[model samples]
Target: MKEERRRHKRLDLDVKIELEKLDEGGVTTVKYIKADVSDLSRSGMGFKSNYKLDVGTFYDTQIQIWTKEVIDAVIEIVRCEEKENNIYQYGACFVGMTETDTLKIDIYQLFNEE
Candidate 1:
């Protein structure tokens, strides 16, 4: 029998976070935690949140890296699934991430070198 292998980029040091949807004109929103990032890709991320966000809902959020550097980006809810503990896992696609923000994330990953 052959064993099946799964491929995924491991994530480390998940910190507590808060995310909020931006307003129409100006960027404003309600801050709420439970936004723990689990998986991250070039164009999206998987996170846990108690708040229910509709698919396609766009949010402008600031991710605080372990280095204390903040990376700001816009994200859109792509999918959501309810977990066993009443916690919700959300998959968000990067809607509009600035080059600087993307670069910051890449650099952080390099230094961490999981």
Candidate 2:
């Protein structure tokens, strides 16, 4: 079995999130896509999307948690795998998430564990 290497625990999630590709300078491009979130953590997230995202690319998006609060974050694609029927699964790390937002996720996770 592959050893777990993640720094934070991931919360299983199922939600749709909008993503806008960011240029090298951190500016948003005209390209936009929607992805289905599979899991979330303070450091990163896993998602699947029909739109293919290049590894090492950055994207801006807002995630709405179970409490209905939205957190804006910029994520960098670290891994991508081509799934069946042209769907892509991606692993992304948060590049521009504030500490407060990260704390919120942690708090939610703590509550969920009980």
Candidate 3:
């Protein structure tokens, strides 16, 4: 059996996340692909995208919560596995998020899950 390795409880979520790829040397790229989040937690989020993303790469992102609030965050890709039809499943962990941003996330989580 496969062992569960998740550190926190996650909610099944479907939301559109805004993403910007960050170059290792701080070069900005114009390549942007739309992605839809599959799940969310305090520590991480998972999404499916048609574009490929390398694991361990950090990205500047904006997640809109409940269609009313938007928070800026940075996330590192923890895992990426190919799905059917050229889709990729990307798992990312939150990084460098502020305390106020976390509280915003908590409020969004509590209200949206029901």
Candidate 4:
């Protein structure tokens, strides 16, 4: 079997995130620290986390402050890696991304480039 490799588009950002798992019941949630967003794309993002996320695990992600301005989307863990410092790296893909969300990301990157 061949290992599935990732082709990534990277942007370095020091953004900290409160990664959360919103329950289906809408009454409970689990919070985790997402150290930074390493690489981001319209489809997904790569972040460093203290906990390991099993490959194929799904979640509802909220981008901390951007919550009110954007719609929440479901994401799936495509890869999880353990680093030397005990940090787990996660590569997740958006499961149901909207075009508006993609535009928002593009706009953010545009401003970032300026």
Candidate achieving the largest TM-score:
2
Q: Rank by TM-score, descending? A: 2, 3, 1, 4
Judged by whole-model lDDT over C-alpha atoms, candidate 2 comes out at 0.92
Per-candidate count of clashing residue pairs (backbone under 3 Å): 0, 0, 0, 0
- Stretch of 10 with least lDDT, candidate 3: 24-33
lDDT of 4 by residue, 32-91 (tens): 546566766667888888777778766776653233365466777888889988898888
Error of 4 at 75 (Å): 1.3
Rank candidates by lDDT, best first.
Answer: 2, 3, 1, 4
Off-target runs (Cα >4 Å) in candidate 1 are 1-10, 23-34
* Per-model lDDT: 0.74, 0.92, 0.82, 0.68
Best by lDDT: 2
Over 4 Å off in model 4, which ranges?
Answer: 1-8, 22-35, 64-71
Candidate 3 lDDT, tens digit per residue, 1-114? Answer: 988778877777778876788887977576666889998778888999998998988788887766467778888999999999999999999986888888877777777767
- Enumerate residue pairs that collide in model 1: none
Candidate 4 yields a Cα-based lDDT of 0.68
CA lDDT of 71 in candidate 3?
A: 72
> What TM-score does structure 1 among the candidates reach?
0.75
Candidate 2 total steric clashes = 0
The predicted structure with the larger TM-score, 1 or 3, is 3
